[model samples]
Target: MKTASIAHRVVDFLRRWPPFQYFDDDELFSLVSAGRVVFHERDELVFMQGRQRKPYVYVIQQGAVRLEEQSEDGVDQLRDVRGEGDLLGIGRYLGFGEHVYTARTETDVILYALPAEAFWETVKRHARASRFLATYFSVAILPPALEMREERSEELRLGRRPVDWMSRPVEQPSRPLTCLPDTAARDVARLLAERDAAAAVVIDGQGAPRGVVTPRTLSDEVASGRQPPDTPAQALMRPVCAVAAPGLEAGDYLTRMLDQQTEHLVLTANGRLDGPFAGVITRRDLTRVEGAAPLALIEDMARAPRISELAALRVQAEGVLAAGLTDPDATRWLAPMAGAFNAAVLRRVVMLVEGALADQGLASPNLDHCWVFFGSAARNELFTRHDLDCGLIYDDPDPGHARGARAYFLELGRRVSAALAACGFVTSAKAISAGHPSACRSVGEWEVAFADWIHQPIESCVYRATSRFDLRPVHGDCRLVERLERHIHGEEDRNPRFVPLLLEDSMANLPPLTFFRGLVVDDEGGYREVLDLLRATLQPVVDIARALALDSGRQAPTTLDRLLVLQPEDDESSLLIEETAAAFRNALYHRARTGLTTGTDGSRVDPAKLTRLEQNLLKSGFRTVLRLMEYTGRRYGLTPRR
Candidate 1:
């Protein structure tokens, strides 16, 4: 009788929430039948700063709750508030250890809770409703309300109208600067110093740029202390590297400067540099505004309330990154910037889960643990759609708070994954999310799992190993992941024999090329080029690097970094791998830039629009992918499967 009454109250509470709002009387009744209700008095703590907790998410019914965060300096500050219709206690259900923040009731509070097992089973049967509910939570449950309404507006706009964030902004110093060829060196230097600038365009009688006198020239000339200060600037001026443009995106302009490592860029109103310097872009300019919209959003996301917001911003940033790939320098700078965004999102996810767990009274105040991202997500080497591969680890073998800690992480994964999906990641068909029981194992359990994968060495294991090797830990008590590194290196160091096997696996997936000399897309015929590019080329680099790193017991953080660290510099094989990776990245940008410009899918490209030179660039890219595969294949004495 008591259980029935509790369930009734729970259903009544759920009826007020959006994702669950449409539930009919019977459906609501069915859902709360498996729920538990709890009561809290004023100033009562439902969860503490650290305690392991059971599996159940909570809903606020009659009173309000406050979520607060414990900072690095040991200060606690209120981060969020929850009241009627709000989903509460999700942290407890997610099961990440050590709450990111603590929670307290502002007044007498009545909450309805549903066990994790019950929630999962029910959500599985109600996939559509669950998705809706997940989306609802992602939108509604951010911490401190995270000032994310602006970014959210972007998402809404994106839903109804495609908005280009990478497009050049309206406000810029587009006015041309001019100087005379006969101007004295001291006079030109005067203009340069007055503007706090580096260069000026020396104009002729026709108002055309005749020669350029830049800070480089002035600095060198003045430092020599030989030429007269009043010497004509024409004697020191040199031809400038100018771009003929029909206007360019800021991304385009930035790419040019970074590629040449030059400070100044000259723009022409027409399509050639000789006409005149319409405007200039200095490294200072890029440095000042480098917090581009996506990066700004990423910075915003570091303090963002929920993973959903982070995910959305991350996807948008990925788009921005893709657009910048139109030039090589942009591609290189964008990679680490992408990593920054990825790391920020990941760090915030951990913080949020930590807060939630603490608020729920599930975290163990003293137990040590760390969280980490795995696979591409870990490396921040993610795509627009990818799985939320993450894990947790523990230091103490028999930490008494094991069960509650594990439970917290499981819940964290559940909520975060749901949020991640709402943000933009494609749903994993295999259900390999950290929320899954098998994937959300403790660090020791992870060791066992990794060991099994390594020792088995079968088809399934090979596939899993490739994914595992790419794993990077982004957040949490990072020692957990460090332990993972030690474990991998320790095992490899002992055996040294698996290196060949891994290299062989690297070559297993051959480069994609049709027998008829056209691109070989997949059986589905969707973005076959992307698949070929990644599998045939990119994966091989990732694989060969992992194998070589393992063989030498070296910890190379990135694929590029791994290539850079190889023993014999300038070796053909190493050079081939590095060059191929670069080419593949360039090809990816080619596709990305074209897509951004034409509103096409970013994954595929129509080769026809490319100029002959562009087409050649792409072919060079594909060949590089092939070459990368071949180099890895040769390294291990294996032939590609294809």
Candidate 2:
């Protein structure tokens, strides 16, 4: 074929794939014009494993190539198959320097050979193209952590910091609302209402902030008839837990608010209790400057009066997650915000359900009872498609009221589950919800159940125990959950067999990857070719992190946080942990983006549609997950199932 005809054909083929699809006509023509075509017969060796790579990368114009690994027995194992539009010999182009797998022609092949340096230079000139290339290369050959660090360093050098978008001074209004300790509670409430303020700060004689009085305090005291209208403000005030010095970055103060779970913070000159109070920075002020602030959404969730209101806020919260997907650091804030919203909604449902029960003359359960969330909800890593996985842990009632209490709580659970469903949460399919009889157990019953699961280690029980192990108190008495956590830790320590069983259970689902180190897609039923990002990518990391954290006696709920707190035994272990953490973050970013764009939970990823960067990150993440699984098996002395 003539030179122009061959170049035109190559350009046509390259345009069908991305980031080439993003290239304009002139760019496409130029890219292909600099490339040359080569033909290989069936069974021909394109590249040999362990040999230095050629200076050019190949793009298949026609036919197929097989990537193979030489086994210890000298037999070749099929790793991956590449066809039209697939880029071959990418390992060396990605700086691997040598081929890990030998590539041979599966059929007579027509390939376009592009100069590696020229192709890289072209990719670097386009931002999207560079990102796609970088992503692909990182997954195929580089460690995700190294890629992330390099990308972040480049961003910093270019003066594009994620914090820059959130950093601003907290706006302070002149003559902020203030009250004296001796002020009547009714008067303080009236003043707050008149000023349209969520809270008011109480100052001492020296103008140092003593406490903050919020609507919650007024509702708990005056409106509930626990205190009279003449009660002093000091009696209704809560000590301010978060205080910051003036002139500090607003982002710093916002971090404090999120950490403390407070809506208001007092600003003092020296950030000391005795220092003169400067002003107050309400959650509202911080949110005004940085919309989608997690602390602000949490405050909004808490104050929502109706289920409908919470449902609306849930959509907004998802929008925040969508925005956060572009920046990996934002994932840290996303989970906590989603958790707070889930907790608020659950609390509201419980309250409504209790009121309905009272109207029907059913007595309330003991105040010592707690509502415990399990699985993703407990980890505070909720996605929009997540189901309700929770149960009730109550103090045993008096002998005469025992039967009645059980009946009452079961009814309450059913009502609460229905209420949550009405607000968009689905009931747990595994019957893990509070409405299930087995889940609505007394504290002693729960202890017995845990002991049974620990001692038995049966398959069915192990599956149930996986969710139960990640317990968190979403509402009611938190002490119950605290006690349960201690019991779980103590049981694990005492039972030598528990850790191995847990490790075995965690290794049940390995990350889906084919022999050629390519992603395995769902070929089952309706979801053909779809990647189960949640199960194949996220779950393995979550399970491994959970087992390690539990074994180390670390109590962090979320997977990423647990991984962060774990003290790896050596430098190699530490590197593995770090790489796995980075991979986890990247997976979260991909899932969030997919969920946002598709209006679903972001659990399913279509590998074909993923950008080069996303694919690379995912591949690197899967690799890390596999390594972690192998480490677990070796550490526990468990043999592979083959």
Candidate 3:
């Protein structure tokens, strides 16, 4: 009877917080039954950083605990303060082998010691509980109230539709079709037919994957008479693309395939090329996953023949974006997939334009070139249609045909831009476009232009030239783009004053926040009480990322990608950087969601329309932006003006 009373008290405490709040009564009671109450005095250490794994985790019944870690200077730096109902030693529950930070009581505290083994066992049956823990642990630091509200929002959104299968763990094939490297091509084909498999994995004697064989191989090689029917499978095999099966979701599989530009992924015991093969995931397999809206759109855009048809398909991309915004878990992968759809449309646009030019009897000045995107499109973060910023770069011509080559490309660039405009990607007002003769230039000319911007450091010229640094080649020869990047970096190395001037230029637009940390709203625009999300918040973050990328010589194109490469000078700076990344994501999501719902460009958002939780989050995000500005000022030795 006494034991039952203790269990009841424990259950009451555990059910008040996540991830335990996500669990049902039976699961909660089971977890609480294995826990016992413990006490700690003020200033007593609960756990030490880098210590071996503990058998149990703690939940605070009352009082607070301070989490800190030793710095390089051998001083303890506080990271977080966990209050009542907060979970401690979460690393053990998450499979972390050692403590990452030392936890010490700030006041006399009562903790419920929950056995890690029992907790794990209880959570395994509760999928929602497990997911909550996963997401909660992934972030740096968030207030408990905000975290709980966000999870509740996620629950409501996720319940409105079927879960995205792409985010689920990919299943290992029970019987993957395999063949020896020495097997005949015809025999490999026959085996695939017998098993009704899409492709066959070529394996060596030790059961390690070597490569893959598809029907396309037969149609291109054996049937085309390039190779005989008796040719060895190894001779016709493409390099094997393999990934580990354990802990990898289907979205992860898709990302790897996109990175390697391959169609097939072989699942193995480990994520090594030489590891034992487990199964295969093909493009065809991905097509079958429900909620593959983005993948389907990309495929449709590739097959679209006319500018009008491509425009219609682009509208479907908005639908995909709308569905993704509602589900927070899926939004993380949405940007890249949406970018892929846009890239396909652009590639088709180029093809159609070239064909049209050929029909007009315009002939033969085929110089190697690359078509690149600038601004948000280049960063792979475009969720809504915005003004297009693009440029064209071609190889230099010989002295004799320079004039003709220039004329041919100029005409081609204008047609490409016109086609894109027809397809709803209207050119930017700044006129930094492929259609303009200034933006269409030879590789040598582009180098000279970039060099001028670096050495001269004029504010207006640098402002006009900033988009070029975010260059991402979507079509044509990539070598030209490579040459340009190398030249830009080399020029920065030579001109020491260039980067600081660039930093100053980036800091030109201050974060829109008042002295009391309130948002600065538009007073002159048609949308009263509305905040311009892009100008007020997102652009400042983008500017900082671009300047840092140029200064560090890191070629990564996206804001998040740039942050990944940056190493903060101190622990405080590191925490701020992490928080800044999170804030940027939240702000971007709000903008995208607003645009899709209101049919506007998504640059402006009315704060009064936001939920109470969103308003709070936005305020928190503004504080983060403010802190970031101070950090930047200190790092660059420049005062940031409000």
Of candidate 2, the 10-residue stretch with the lowest lDDT total is 152-161
* 1-642 per-residue lDDT for model 1 (tens digits): 687776766676676564366456775676677666789999998787776655666777788787766778997755455567665555533335555557889889987776656555554444333533343222123222122221221111112222233345423465455688778888888887877765687777765666668877887886578678887877888776555363566555554443333456765556465564566665555556443354345557776777667776776766666544535434445554555565566567667766877788765535466655565555445434445566556555456767766776677777666655666656556435767776677778777776666666673465664666656655556677788778877766665557777777676655433211123432122223233335544556667777777777777666666776777444665556556556656544553454345544344554434432343344445455556666666666777664
| Ranking of candidates on TM-score, top first | 2, 3, 1
lDDT of 3 by residue, 200-239 (tens): 8898988889988998897799999999999999999887
Candidate 2 residue-wise lDDT, 1-642, digit = tens:
788887887888898775677577887787677778899999999899989988788888788787788988998856556677677776655458989899999789999898877676666556556555555443324423232323342211211224444546766757678899999998998998998887888999999999999988999989999999888888888997568887766666665675456877888889988888888887778767765367767777777777788777777766665554445555565566567667767877788778778999887755489998888788877656457588999987887878888898888988888778777775545647788888898887898888788877784477666878888887778788888888888988898788777778777765654212233522111123667877766887888788888888977978888988988788778788888877787777667666667766678877767544455566667667777888878889864232
| Residue pairs in clash, model 2 | 79-516, 80-516, 135-613, 136-612
Runs of candidate 2 exceeding 4 Å displacement: 19-34, 71-79, 93-95, 139-210, 214-233, 239-262, 266-280, 292-330, 514-528, 569-575, 589-602, 605-613, 639-642
Flag the better candidate by lDDT, 1 or 2. Answer: 2
Those runs of model 3 whose alpha carbons end farther than 4 Å from true positions after fitting are 1-140, 143-167, 174-184, 201-212, 217-247, 256-263, 266-279, 287-291, 327-329, 514-528
Q: Estimate each model's TM-score.
A: 0.50, 0.81, 0.70
Residue 172 miss distance in model 1 (angstroms):
25
